[model samples]
Target: MNPTEWRTYLVTQESRSAGRETAAVVEAALSGGVDAVQLREKGRPARERYELGRRLRDLTADAGVPLIVNDRIDLAAAVDADGVHLGQSDLPAEIARGRLGDEAIVGVSASTVPEARAAAEAGADYLGVGAVYRTGTKDVPDETNGVGPERVAAIADAVDLPVVGIGGIDAGNAGAVTAAGAAGVAVVSAVTAAADPRAAAAELREVVGDGR
Candidate 1:
């Protein structure tokens, strides 16, 4: 997948991942038009995470959607995942690029223009920006305080890479982020916790596509 296609992203399978297994939710999301999937299993043992990544790798490969492993470059490399998403505190993008090589996608989380620019300069293929709204899916630093659409616009303006607005995003407000110049939105609970994961993903895809 190319940078432009990161739109309609899904960051997967949290504890709130209700009703179905993580793989099932991801399968349904891919079928529903999620362009990419990030396997973000924090707090699990490396072995457990690796096994899960392997399962997701097969599923995502079959669907032809990019699967990004969160944080663990080793796990990503082990599974030959399409990419890895790094946080501010994680490994530097340049180093990740070195380890993952040129073909693998490297995305970094950024909350400011400077951070976004640095990530881009460091060889990041895309940027995940926000806490666009207050969200409990992941613990965000209090300083971020939900940067909102304007910050997303600013970061989009500052960075040459694709910017995906994450945190508390759903079909209702996804358009605002897209209109603010984000190439896409990264969602967690909005899809994972939904009664119908496929339907939820489809709705979000519609909303984001309309925004673009």
Candidate 2:
């Protein structure tokens, strides 16, 4: 993937069955037009996470979409994932760069103007911004966080890197998300929790225009 695709879909596993359901949901998302998939399963046992990473990497590879592991450089390397996506609380972009090298794609989450600029300067390939609408994740959320499209636009305007919008985005309101300047939208529960994962992914693709 070029990493500049207009609609990047992220799949983060949040519950007990996340590991088991991740592959199928990710495959459906790819079939529906997701450019990149990030395997973000936090707080799980290391052994479980490693196996999950392997499954995601294989599925993404077969689908021809890049798979990035969230917050774990070691697991990324272990599973031969395409890259790593890091949050502000995770490893620094420059250090991640050093660890992963220039060939891999590295993304950093940024909420404020300075943070976005710093991540760019530090060599991040892209930026993931939000909690745009209050997410089920993030305990002590970013201060500037909110799902307002305007706020997401503000962050996008502040940096040159490709931007991905996260936090509560879905079919009912994804239009405002893209209109706000997001290159893509990352979701967890929307597709995974749906009765039909493929249908959910297809609907989201319609909302975001299949990454254009």
Candidate 3:
């Protein structure tokens, strides 16, 4: 899928929620209008992560949505995923692009304008920019405070690629991110941890529409 197509993104399956299976949650989210799904299970064994990536690739493919593997280029290639999302410590976007080739999508995470600009120059197809609100969804570093919606706007302005706001995003604040110039919002707990993942995704999609 093209970067512009990522209007409602879901970063997934962190084993923290009771009775919330990753495959089930992804299926539900897709049904409710999640445009893209990022398989982000960092703590799992490689075999487990690969198996889940394969399952999600099939699920997302069936839904005609892009499935992006987080921080694992090899896993993504193995599963034939649509793309891979890279963090600052991961392989550079240009190198990933070289390995994945022109047809594959590559996204990089950035919290500041310079990072966003550098990612753009490195040939990233899109940018994941935030910590837009205080989030415990991922293990963030001490120096990285939530940059908020204003930072999303700043990063968007600094780069030509599509930008998706991530971290602590939900239906309530998703619209604000979109209004601040993010092409989309990426969420983890908001959808993955919800009692009704499908309903939660739908609600967030609705809120994003209001902002657009």
Query: After best superposition, candidate 2 residue 208: deviation in angstroms?
Result: 1.1
lDDT of 1 by residue, 1-212 (tens): 98677668888865878867788889888889899999997887889888888999998899888989999899999998998999999999988899999999999999999999999999999999998998878789887858999999999998788999999899999999999999899999999999998999999999988899
Q: Candidate 1 vs candidate 2: which has greater lDDT? A: 1
lDDT of 3: 0.88
Clashes (N, CA, C under 3 Å) per candidate: 0, 4, 0
- lDDT (Cα, tens digit) per residue for candidate 2, span 118-144: 999999988887777877655536564
- C-alpha RMSD for every candidate: 0.9, 2.2, 1.0
TM-score of each: 0.98, 0.91, 0.97
lDDT (CA) for every model shown?
Answer: 0.90, 0.78, 0.88
Angstrom error at residue 91, model 1: 0.7
Q: Is candidate 2 or candidate 3 better by lDDT?
A: 3
